[model samples]
Target: MRLFLVSQLLLVFISVLALTRAQTAPPTTTDTATTETSTAQPTPTDTATTTQAIAIATTTAWTAPPIFYPFGSAAGDTEQFENGGDTYRDVAFSTPFMFFGRMYNNTYVNNNGLLTFNQPLPEAHPYPFPTHGSEDFIAPLWTELDDIGIGRYSYQQYTNGSVLTRASQEINQYFPHKGFSASWVFVATWDYVQTSDVNVLNLHSAPAITFQVVLISGGGYSFILMNYGDCAATYYPVEAGYDTISSTDYHVIHYAFDGSYIPNLKNTSNVNVPGRWAFLVNNGTETENVIGVQLKLSSFLDLTLNENIEDVLQKIKQELVNRGASSFFEMKLRNVETDKEKNVAGRETFELITLT
Candidate 1:
């Protein structure tokens, strides 16, 4: 009886140890996989999210960078240079001063330095109208406005305003006093909402139709509407006397009409317009014919200063834009100004001095 009782206790101990091992030991691979498949399996939505993330990463990858456009000349000396990073070409110039720079206006930047186009290019920003090396360094942004004067210029902050209906705007655009403004009024067939500010060359459109407008701040400009679709807006002619100067406000209006009235109002079958104010008047409603307008500051300068850098180690970070080149570059340095006065230089000063 004693031996049987001892055997029974041993059997119970072995069974209890087996049960504890089974509960505490790691699960087999097949068992773990079965549990994960039901709870942690990747869904279709998760797979699609991963795929789109990779596509965005691939498309936005930066191009081979650190591009350099190096230029300079020491007053009447012939100078030649080459870009070590990019351009895949050499530049040579025999002139007094070579135009090169990115920013820091009025101060000479470098006699031997490079202008970097992509200082970490952003995904979106104001792009230059004419890219560099286009037209042999001739800035394309001023292609239409170049006939007025060749200069380094951009739209000023003081000149920011929307076109008010029936309200005449007299904008004193940039320094040296160039460009034109108008008091304009219009009636649209659809409910009109002039929400976007009419920047000089930015495209503005209505949701109803495919037509667009640009209020380029030049004396004479041509706007080509990238029109498409099943809908097109038709423009009418101005009244016989709408182009006359307003007697009360002394505001002048000019119209280039279809030749039932004015002998010169014939369409030349070309898209280019002469730098004069005109209206496409049809049947007499000003709004029906005035699809667009041209404000005029028609002057001409032959050349512009581009760079004013004085330090070799200093490089202003700027996005490479085809904003195009200007014949005259005007700059202002707030650092050179005092609270009471501005220590600006004259626009007519240039140099050809030898450092030796």
Candidate 2:
């Protein structure tokens, strides 16, 4: 009877120990997974909560504020340079500006309302953009502008925190989805600049053109903002836009090509804000037009009808393809006559071709 009693106690103790171990030990992988799946199943309340979170995130969209910057003596900032007629001042950039694919560490700020890289364009007169010109330039009112006597022009560059923040915010508002942050900004203002023709023609009165060109760059991206303020009508040919070397990329502002409609620039805008135009110019794949590509080809290739014409056509086709042109597009050569010797300074006079 004692032996049987001892055996029963031992069995009871072993069972108790097993129960304790089972209670204290970590669960097996399969058991843990089963428990999680059972409890973690989505309820209607969880679905509603997730949907609400997504809605809240989507509702918080960002919008850019006003597009204006301070300038002149009253603004108590900016570096003023000597003003002249048809002359340009070589200004070194605090940071290099990447344009198209070229990097420029300096620029020639011309008095006639333009910024030219590679060389200075001191001509008092203005020409239409996509001139197929060799020099790459940015014109905010490229005319015979004179700030020598009556007007003031100044520039300021920013690497400061506040200005960088403002630049980032303004660019984000204009070109969204890039999540851009501006590391450098250069602001050039042509305040109350008068037309050079006024003095030459001896006019009793002339209109004053006020505008600003702001360069914002960061993270291999570059942008330009042309801001107009109270641009009055002028009798000079004013071209407002930018052109790349070989005319690969160019944009001409509406009404700016004709001199008579100069005042319209003050109220017109590309971003819905009056007197403002913004453009992304560093990698200009998005801004380049089909016409620009044709011009680019004209600048390089001698599109003469020769025995190797087939090879020339194939070369042109391949060039277009290399530049992201669709294979299904149509191209037509217009006015390829031999008498059309309008090619001057690498600018072909005859319309080489049109791409559609």
Candidate 3:
């Protein structure tokens, strides 16, 4: 009986030892698997972090906004010549009038009435006169035409109230060897009366005649003219008033003229007959004058004028200034015509405006 009891105890002790060994062996395998899993997870996480960092570093920077410079006025002071005054003329004669560094007069008029070839007006006879009627008629003068280096030449004549002929001349020799191209405005300030006779005659004319820049050659020549008449007869003759004209690309050349005549020509003699015109080389710049806001520049890209374009231009100008552009590169403003007629009962103002 004692031997049997001892055997049972020995068997129980062996079973306990086997159970302990089995439980401890599983723990060892589990620990190894946990370590492997942790290590594998970190590799993918690290790779993802590295990729995210690279993408952030490669992002592009933002572009700055554009800017705008004004060409006209915003407020009051009736007599002042500054932009905002009531009587202030929004006419721009020449702004930044530069071509290859030298400043050339952009306002030119080629009427045969005002100048005798090569002869600038005597200081006394500044105003233009008719070419034919008066024996005293002076040949029209041109300061720069003889010196123009390149371009074709042409001439037209008006006779008996009609266009008589057009002629072309190969006068390259007459032009200057090298000169910067420019634009100009032509103005005619006159008082016309409906004569009892069939033919129209000038009752009392204050004709301010000038010539324009006509391109004979090269890709960038444009001529423009604007005439603003003060009396009713003058305005009615041309059907001139508020009007807007456009061109293809801003760089494309275009020519236009505007004129207006006031009623009761005698009463408004003091009121000036103002004209506005411009010539742009290489690129055409657009300007707008609003009553309340600063002047705006239109985009040259599409050459389409829009209400908000001015705002965008202003932003662009600000950005360019921030980017270190000089004030000379900044846009300029000008008033071309300001002189008032002295002889007329009512003041008649005439100007040749240009905006560079």
Candidate 4:
């Protein structure tokens, strides 16, 4: 009985040990699986953090602002104008004639047609009409009226048998003693007058006449006019691109007047004045029109025209590399002056810098 009891106790101890070992082994497997899942999750987190860093880098890149320079003065300077007189006529008839007036009274017309108060009339002409016939007699009077001042001039003529009646407009001054002067002259006539009708009914009228005088400096002048009424808007088409330093990615792009390229002067055609440069931006697959800024010609030539064109391209490549944009982005230089062949000083090549 004692032996049997001792054997039973040993068996019981062995069974308890086996049970404990089985429980401990499952926990080891569970711990290993949990560690593997934690490691795998951290890898995704690292990838997400990397993506966020890239986004931040791209957003912070510097882009240049648009710059605009007007032809005459700094942007937003008010234009000046001056008015001299109204109607004072020594009447005549027949022939086309020009009216003259004092801008700065008693002023002389400079080589540029600018008037200085102390100078003499620079140019003179016999009134536009001849001093002959019934119509010719009245022409000088109209010329005299035009020379008296700066303003729009209108004339009317009436005839009864051989008698002709004439009238002209008086000057209405708005801008006084300003730097600019302008004038307009209109002439019209009828073929004949009826025996009893004082009112001229049938008349053939010429187009209205208009002219302007802009004094730039002491001797500079600009005379402008629009003879015809029909005017149309101007348009320009442009293509641009950039290339990588290693000649990796070269992109070619085009834009129309009404498309992505927005010009500063929307109403007029590009004048292509000397010393003007433009900047363009990438708008996804389509690039924005060369409208971001107007870099001065001096600045562009200084920055872009040094050394060989190829060398400049390499410099652009270096810039990309310094910015840490080497692996994924590239630029190819495209020719920008081809469309402006007449304005090109020489056969210079333009480069396109593209990002891949």
Candidate 5:
């Protein structure tokens, strides 16, 4: 009887051990398939989906922002451009405006889109800067724009305390160097101006381009502000920017060479302000120093795009060190890095970047 009891107890213990082992065993294939189903149901492609969304946002069309001065007949102080093709009107500034180391008290506002100091550029066709031309002009949009009985173009100058304060604040914010105070402000606007190539009788039915070129001067410093509004597409050669006497100091706004991109100027900006671009037209002694250094460096670097990029960079770096202009080189490197992040390699204008 004792031996029987011992064997029975031992069998019960063995049974309990086997039951525990079964409970603790690995999962079955079905269990694994269920888990994988939850994880693999198109949920792993989130990163790619986000990347696609970002690309769409980046490629979206740009529009003009409201950063322009008030204009039109309602403004009451504006002088209107005549309703004729390729017409120009001479206007005298209340104060002498300094531009690129020169002073001017009078300029002609041409309907085709240019401000000339000496005479009117009656030609409707646009030309690239350094035209090696004798005329000094500021072209907001040098296109064949027909204002004949259609669009209205106008000009206004302000020397009021309120206007001066606003101009000072804007220039300081955009350029951000030494503080600037404006004593004189000249505003020329091309409002609802249609391309001459268009044959529409009703201006409302035709596409139009509206923009402004504001000249600000004070404390021996000068600035130019190009404010764009709704711009229509065009097929003609369009040039927008400025040139000094003999093209000694000149800059062509981006997309000025291509007609398709002319409308894009309404959205493009140099200071990251949409619809607006601000440029320091005169820097006094600083301009002289830069030109001198530029000439010295130009002798070493072939900016004609004939040399390899790496070779050009090496030459510039060595020349900067020899001339104690390494600070300028470093600043350019920082600018290049910043522009690279924006993916504007060919579109951006940096110091010594003109490939003329």
Candidate 6:
């Protein structure tokens, strides 16, 4: 009877163990949704070969937008450029298939091709976003779009009262030099979060006049923009920045805005309001939209694209002492090496505003 009892007990224990396992086991999912979520993120792609830099500074005046639409059925069709530009197609592609590099596919080269900026923004933007190199800009804390280089976000917009056309407090271009104009675009996006008395967007902060500049390869970038700064930054000159992405990359930029043109304006004007500027070191993500801040641009009569990105970086280092951070600045260079190469992007210039 004891042996029989022992065998029965053993069987009971095995049964209980099997029941527990079954209860705790995870269910096998065969649905497509489950499969997609399980492996949604893409692995990092190999670094691309360093591209040759292009110089856009022609002596002739640029009557047309830097990019030309390759194909179209009408003259008024609307399209967004790769580098965050919304446009109203003024004239169709009249120039010989000219091109410029922009946030991935700034132009709709595909028109019907199915392979441009073809990924979701989350997957397309750079990961580990370069929030680490805040010190370079001189600000202990960095704001949005600080070092964002050019990507394929800009497109053509052909509307009358869209965000690209309306809401510009000022869309003044500068003739920093005789032969060239500070040709940059400044668009107003949504408001950003801030806690300053400066009253951005009449009250809110950040996302002030989203802007961008072009690189050596003709890609648009955001190097300078408006911001909601700290106590010290809110007053006098204002809190602004120029990150390493634009400072280090690119050949030349025509920072469209200039506060000095209007004397005695720092106390009231947005141009003079931005005083302290900083540069954030590259975070090493080659392909991502960047953030930006406001800056005081210097009057450059003949700024040209730099031949070497390193030289441009070194010049910026020197300017920290020469120009200092007192509002008022200027930069002219082109080309950014990809993470595959340390290069990247813009201008009032919002090049990369990546606040998602």
- Candidate 3: segments with Cα more than 4 A from true spot: 26-31, 38-41, 44-356
**RMSD (CA, Å), each prediction:** 25.1, 23.4, 27.7, 32.6, 19.9, 25.9
TM-score of predicted structure 3 = 0.21
Model 1 agreement with the true structure over 1-356: per-residue lDDT tens digits: 99999999999999999999999999899999999888895789999999999987655622111110111121122222211111111222111111221111111111111111223211122122222222111111111111111111111111223432111222222112333333222110101112232221122232111111112222221111111111112132211111111111011111222213222322111113211222121111112121122212111221132323211001110100012111122222212212212213322222221110
Question: What is the C-alpha lDDT profile of model 4 across 1-356, one tens digit per residue?
Answer: 99999999999999999999888875578898998888775578889999999987655622111211121112222222212232123224322222111132122222211122332322322222111222101110111212322222222222221111111111112112323222222222111111122121111122111211211111121111111111111132222222222233322222233212322222221112211111111111233234122111211342345344544554555455334332224344444443235445543335364544
TM-score sort, best first: 5, 2, 6, 3, 1, 4
Poorest 10 consecutive residues by lDDT, candidate 2: 196-205
Q: State the lDDT of candidate 3 residue by residue for 235-303, as single tens digits.
A: 111111111111111111111121232222222211122222222222223243322224323223322
Q: Rate the local accuracy (lDDT) of all candidates.
A: 0.22, 0.68, 0.26, 0.27, 0.67, 0.26
Worst 10 residues of 3 by lDDT: 63-72
The alpha-carbon root-mean-square deviation between model 2 and the true structure, to one decimal in Å, is 23.4
Candidate 2 C-alpha error for residue 277, in Å: 0.5
* Local error of candidate 5 at residue 262 (angstroms): 1.5
Alpha-carbon error at 324 in model 1, in Å?
A: 41
Considering TM-score, which of the candidate structures 4 and 5 is the better prediction for this target?
A: 5
- Could you tell me the lDDT of residue 221 within candidate 6? 21
> What lDDT would candidate 2 get against the real structure?
0.68
Candidate number with greatest lDDT: 2
The true-versus-predicted C-alpha distance at residue 326 of model 2, in Å, is 18
Higher-scoring candidate on lDDT, 1 or 2: 2
In Å, residue 34's CA in model 3 sits off its true spot by 6.0
After superposition, which runs of candidate 6 have C-alpha atoms over 4 Å from their true positions?
1-175, 179-188, 193-356
Q: Scored by Cα lDDT, where does model 5 land?
A: 0.67
